[model samples]
Target: MRQYSIADLESRLAPSPRMPVLFVGHGNPMHAISDNAFTREWSRIGADLPEAQAIVVISAHWLTPGSTHITDAPRNRVIYDFGGFPDALSRVPYPSEGDPVVARAIRQQFLDYEAQLDAQWGLDHGTWSVLVHLAPEPTVPVLQISLDYAMPLPELHATFARLRALRDRGVLFIGSGNIVHALGRARWEPHAQAWDWAVEFDRVTGDALRERRVDQLLDPFRTWDTARIAVPTDDHYRPMVAAMSLLDPDEDLSFFNEQIDMGSIGMRSFMTA
Candidate 1:
């Protein structure tokens, strides 16, 4: 396959409003209500990104057993799925409106999966935390799609690829999850440095993303021993797969927030145009 630059990707999608896809490794829930470096970058990204007609977020926080669900409500409410966080986080609201039309369209497009329209399960920290900085006013229609926890990485990739049709339709997709999220092994201090294995896993993931070898990421636990420590669970790692599935062989990719947090969480994020 031939690699394409940003210009080539833009030229190929000529006359159509093609939107780039993003994968954000949202680390701490505190970033939602706090004004930090990550949040500031999210704001800058919001300003620099192309104006999207609608936004769809595939968050790691929303996981279903055997079926996928898409938010179809007219309006979205914040779902504080996490606990032990500050009270301020609970008070923060993102009330982004939802587009049933677009949500229904997504359901129809994902014919290979058991996709269903859902009225409940609002935006989780994986979404609103970033959106609170990305789109402060939150006027755009936003939708959240659930990940089928039982699906394999390959099937999840194909299921998410179905959304590629919406790229030219002015829909922006955001996959929110961490590449390395070993929460149990994290150092809780503020000045903690990343572990060696965590850094190595992140580097490997970055290499795969830059070279467009997304297949290399499907089973990191089997490929690298470090992955067992970096990705003990699939929840966070799966969102990266979902985001990668949206990219074609000829798109330009760029990284952001390339750092590990609390010695474990890899906050490396990327965008494919």
Candidate 2:
């Protein structure tokens, strides 16, 4: 396979606007409402990033059994997907308008079956929690792309590749989920340190991401036991695969918020232009 540069990737869809692609490792919902380092970084990215016509977030929260769906609400309301959080967290509304044109562009990008435009779906925790920090006002049009868990691996990867061209369409694609999300072993206390296995798993993932050996990520069991402990489910880890697919060989890579929190959640994020 040919390794394309950022320039080459944009040239394919030249004359269209181009923007950076981001994979944000959102650890906890509290990060959204808090004024901490992580949220500060997110807000900084928002201020620094170019004026985006639309933002398409592929969140781990909205999982589909068979096919993918894109949120198409003209004015999307926040849907508090998680429970047990404070009422203020649930009441937080991220009212980012939807773009039908961009949504259509996303659907049309597919070579196979088209992605469906979902009117019912709203901003889930995986998406809004991060976006609220990134785009506080969120006046920019925001569309969400749901994960099709039942889709075959090769096919899902192919879909991610197709989504890369969206950058040139003035759309910033964001993958929202942690690299290591082991809620079962998470500590409730703030400033909790990461476990040894969590550190190892995060390091391995970062290495794979930097080396462009993303396929190795699909099968972690043969590589390290720590990875098995890190990723018991695909929801969190799968977003990274999509992020990897967007990588351009010649583009500069940037990472931020490299801290692992609550013992298991790896708050490691990266980006490429």
lDDT per residue as tens, model 2, 1-273: 233455553443334556888999988888778898999999888888887767888898989878899887778878888778888897787877986656666776775776888989988888889988888887578888888998755567768888776777677889998889898999879788888899999998788777776567766667768877898887887777777677676677788998898998999999874
What's model 1's TM-score?
Answer: 0.93
Q: Each candidate's TM vs. the true structure?
A: 0.93, 0.91
Per-residue lDDT for 61-165 in model 1, tens only?
999989999998889988998899889989998878996777767776787566988998789989999998888886679999999999999889989998898
lDDT of candidate 2?
0.80
Q: Give the Cα error of residue 253 in candidate 1, in Å.
A: 0.8
- What is the C-alpha local distance difference test score of each model? 0.87, 0.80
Best candidate according to lDDT: 1
Stretches of model 1 off by over 4 angstroms after superposition: 1-15
